[model samples]
Target: MEKNHEFIRYVLPKGKTFSGLTQAQATLIANHINSTARASLNGCTPFELALLLLDRKLLELCHMAWIPADQVTLKPTLLK
Candidate 1:
């Protein structure tokens, strides 16, 4: 979260995708999420969220992981 704070354009409430990002920067965000307090997420980890999405192709776990970050913001639903 703090990683993107420098780029308020990404969290503009209206969102701003397609922005420039490096693999290292992405890893920073992932690590930040991994190190944060996730007990409020029903005992699930952020990596698990990504794994589940790839395994089940569903966003049903968004409530447990948190929206817009846990899952892709694309409109083309990966799961019905």
Candidate 2:
């Protein structure tokens, strides 16, 4: 999907290859992304919405966590 591509581009370092990205780095990025509030979600973050709607066990199985809104980081420094 185009959004997925955009997210990948947003998270990846400029001029860097995604192939070099590690799983831990990806997880960190993912957590930050999910923690971000979106207009599409009426300003509620994906993590908050998931916690309200999805089963807690399922969330735990996926290793998802609620990153505090103030702590969310979507910049290149996040992966540094």
Candidate 3:
């Protein structure tokens, strides 16, 4: 929730509206965010945590995939 919204706000340009975002753009943002390492997770990314704790079928249903560390992009330009 709040954290997810905050991440989205941080990744999008100022004054940009969510309605203008395409599905592909949204998925890219989500993938990048999940792929990023977090201190709260003890350096593990959300994607890694999910892989360890969640069912593979559920993840597949959600279209989630592991983004390589070197390939993860957190910048607003990710949507561009």
Winning model by lDDT:
3
Candidates sorted by lDDT, best first: 3, 2, 1
Model 3 deviation from the true structure expressed as Cα RMSD, one decimal place: 1.7
Candidate that scores best on TM-score: 3
**RMSD for each model, in Å, please?**
12.2, 2.0, 1.7
Off by over 4 Å in 1: 1-14, 40-80
TM-score of each: 0.32, 0.79, 0.82
Residue pairs in candidate 3 whose N, alpha carbon or C atoms collide under 3 angstroms = none
- Candidate order, TM-score descending: 3, 2, 1
Per-residue lDDT tens digits for candidate 1, residues 1-80, read 44345433332324545356555444444444443335655766565656556653343333223334445432212212
lDDT of 2 by residue, 1-80 (tens): 35545666676756978787787787777788888788888998888999999999998877788789899776677888
Which model, 2 or 3, shows the larger TM-score? Answer: 3
